[model samples]
Target: MDGHHHTAHSVFPKVSTTGKKGKDQKSAKSAKKPRKAEVNYLPPYPTGENEESQEQERIQLLTEAPTNPNSNLTRDVVIRCLIVYLEESLDHVLKRYDDADEDSVSQDLTVQRMKIYSIKTNTSDCPDDVGIVVEGMKVLAALGNFPRACSMLLGLTYAVNVANPKELRYTFEVFQKFLLELDCSKLSPKVNSLKNKTASLGKWALAK
Candidate 1:
């Protein structure tokens, strides 16, 4: 009877030790498990307020242009936006002219005259291009008097030189055609004599 009791007691200690070992194994596994990482999510589209802010930034950049032509600040900003604004205004005015109830001969006259001089002309569309040469001259005319227009053209000529060779050459050709097409009669008295002399020289060159 004593030996049987002692055997039962020894069995209980072995069972308790096994249970403790199992608990330790579970605790170690819990410690080894990794925590999940947090994630950040972003919206796909810009809000209306964000768009307005960007537009304001563009307007401010254009209005307060820096004097330095080589300013790095202007590199990423497209100055063509200004040119586009000017072109669109020209398009609007030209559209008004087209919409006027004039004879087809009078209507077709401008396009025909431009077609004769344009390196690349578009005649098929509703508002077909008279080439950049004619379009630029029209813009100059729409801007009112001559001196301001000349300054604008000279500034653009300088600016165009900074572009790629293809753009530079195309713009130069447009200016060359424009100079050839310029009428001395439209010039203001302030610049008339000087511009007439310059026009004569240009005509001489174009004759070559």
Candidate 2:
């Protein structure tokens, strides 16, 4: 996004007005583009490469990567890449199910089973938290709205066998008193206390 005009300019490099280096060049040579610099998408997006061997690996690092201490930049990248992953995940699913025979079995083409990842090859010192998607849930996380993100996450999990984010567990907890992460089997010892406290807040909020 930030590089749109720059990309266009590269495709059609400006005529060098300095000397014969510009004049002697043929039209094809003038139109030839230079190599692109690696993009880090630091302000809110990123992808360095992809050699993932498992579906889980595609998103493992992105979810568990430390949330940037700079939430501002993290927020921005999260919002931007969220869209990328949503669109890209669909793109991946479509490509995977491109066979003509699958038309008879549309359910197999559904994207709920798709794993998310940046298809980006050009990259540099990328922030760890950057990635593309868990779909609707993916986009919500990308939008920097973790509460909504959590809601979609839980709903998606219950719908399909969507995996819970292992590293960023707090982002999707139902309440501070008790989390509903599927990976965690036992309820917190303090859950009852937390439930009471949350109930108290609600009761006080509705005081008559």
Candidate 3:
């Protein structure tokens, strides 16, 4: 009976050991495996040289700027310069006409006519104003129509006096040079009489 009891205890311990081993296997199967670690990636940053090159390109573009035609020389300045040159040339011709002697009349007239042509050619496209008045005087002078020239001069003086006092003085000075230099004896009787009247008027008008 003792031998049989010992054998029964040994058998019960063996059964329990086998049951524990089976439970351990089931627990291992149900558990999850460990996951791989996650990786993060970032974009490459610009180097110092690349940044400097980019800045230089921007500066080069700014340095080679284009010109603006509208911003260049204004229309008013061009008009004023043209007027001043034309008036000066007219003064020169009138002086030559007055100062030339009897022996030089033919040469003087030819020279004066050429100057008139030049004035007309240059100012043909000019808009009306003092310039047109001066242009008319040149044309009359070229035609040897001293009476018409005197009339134009008188009109110019009046226009200048009313328009711009500063320009009036300049116009009078130029007219005086012409009158003072012209040969009074060579002029037609009508022209001589009109010249005297216009000279007197010009002086009076410019006095103010």
Candidate 4:
């Protein structure tokens, strides 16, 4: 009985030692395990630096761009309005003349004529007023009013000479061509006589 008890006691010690060894090995493995890295999440949005860079790019693009078509269209509209105003004023003067209101016609004509001169002076870069004057002279000539037409033409000649001397030679040549093409027999007797005088004057003037 004593020998059997000793053998059982020795077996109990061996089982206890095996259990302690397994526990130590598990603790060592747990300690050696790698730690997981931490992660952060952010909402999608532009940062301050990114926003500033985008703003600068936009400003640079605007500054380097060409002039817009809308701006050019606005300028063209303004010019057209000025031309229409001038035409309406002249038309009013002509209407007064047709109504036989001599004094009123003369006043309106003088005012409108001065307005044309003002336009030419202010818009020296545009020669549109010269074309207007030429058209007015043609209308007067068609109405059998040679004297008034000639006066308008003379005024145009003077204005062109002073304001745009470089264009004067071409303008005079056009005027001469227009006169030569007219049928003299269709003109009133007074107009025919005046035409002969103008032809002589034009020849002399051009010769110089």
Candidate 5:
């Protein structure tokens, strides 16, 4: 009987439920360790090649306009797309004519700016802000493209009707700042006249 009892006890080894519970608890705790979260982000500034590709994509989107006459191609959407195209065109101009004269370099830029203004003119409801145009002028002036800068500034001023006093003042301030930084000797008589015309417009607003 003793031998049978020993055999039975041995066959059914005493396993503590507490031990099993502890093991499970350990596994659960281990499984709950925090991991670093992964995130994907877009680049702030695209490379030259990326700019070209993106511009082409935007053009393709323009061409593939919905056939339906009732399609919603909003002015804001078109303007945004055109702005992107202008940026891309500027990049292209900079890249392509790295060694060209200012006149030659400004050709493409002039065309693009005119095109943007033309679109803005057509969409009278969408008021043109001179911010982007001012920025382009600043860049051209910095690059010693003074004549082109002057021409662009004058043309843009005429094209964009800044009825908003705040916007007009701000645009003139930016333009005047650009003029101040220009090499006076490089500026033509026409440029000087243009500068004189806008002389009364100044008093920069505090930056937001």
Candidate 6:
């Protein structure tokens, strides 16, 4: 009985040593394991540096606009040397006065305005063309040639359903309101929309 008890006690020490060796092996393996690297997630957006570069590109485009024909800032000066030539050419019905009548003065002014209209009807295909045409007509009116200005516009209308020049909304206020008091419903949708806005704004601004 004594020998059996001694043998059982000796077996327990060997089992405990095996468990300690396993624990030491597990600790060493844990120390050898590599740590995962932390990842950095960022939002996709334009930073300050990107924004500055974009701004610089925009400014470069603006600086190179002088030679650009499509630029709105392009200067379109009238030919100064031809001014005198045009003015002197306004002599109509001077060779014979017998053919003149009460309408001669009005008719003569109309002829002069037509001369100006000939120059204004250049029909610039540029986006700023409408502004140029409108400015010329306004100048004609200012120069006491309103009839000729009206005549030039009427001449354009003869075309079958011609489109309003670039920026139809702007052309509406400048040309249609300045010269013709035509029915608004007949104009382009853009022009009609602009007129609606103007009417609404006018009504809004009006005091009760």
Best-performing candidate as measured by TM-score: 2
The lDDT for every candidate, in the order shown, is: 0.32, 0.36, 0.35, 0.34, 0.34, 0.33
Which 10 residues in a row give candidate 6 its minimum summed lDDT? 36-45
What are the candidates' C-alpha RMSDs?
Answer: 32.4, 20.2, 48.0, 43.7, 28.3, 37.2
Residue by residue across 1-208, what tens digits does model 2's lDDT show?
1133123333443444444444566654675443323221122112332223222442442454355436544654653454353232223321221223434323432344433322212343332232224532233224223323333444444334444454333333322114332323344444444456768999999995
Superposed model 2: Cα runs more than 4 Å off: 1-147, 168-186, 205-208
TM-score for each predicted model, relative to the true structure = 0.16, 0.25, 0.16, 0.19, 0.17, 0.22
Residue-level lDDT tens digits of model 4 in 41-109:
111112332334545654553443244545434544543443353232222212223323435534444
Tens digit of lDDT per residue, candidate 6, span 1-208?
A: 1122223333433222233467787876575422222111111112332334545654664455444644323212122222222232212201112323536623443433212322222344322111113322322222212222333443343221333433233442334442234332265555456567768898988954
Report lDDT (Cα) of residue 94, candidate 6: 13
How many collisions per candidate?
0, 2, 2, 0, 0, 0
User: lDDT tens digits, residues 1-208, model 3?
Assistant: 1122223333443222233458788986785643322111111112332334545644553343224323223433442343464343334323323333445543444433212221222333421212122322332333222222333443333323223224334433333333333112355444455567778999999997
What residue pairs clash in candidate 6, if any at all?
none
Clashes of 1: 0
Task: TM-score for candidate 4, please give it.
Answer: 0.19
lDDT of 1 by residue, 160-180 (tens): 322212323323233333332
Q: Pick the winner on lDDT between candidates 3 and 5.
A: 3
Candidate 5 — which residues are off by over 4 angstroms? 1-49, 66-208
lDDT of 6 at 76: 20
Better of 1 and 6 by lDDT: 6
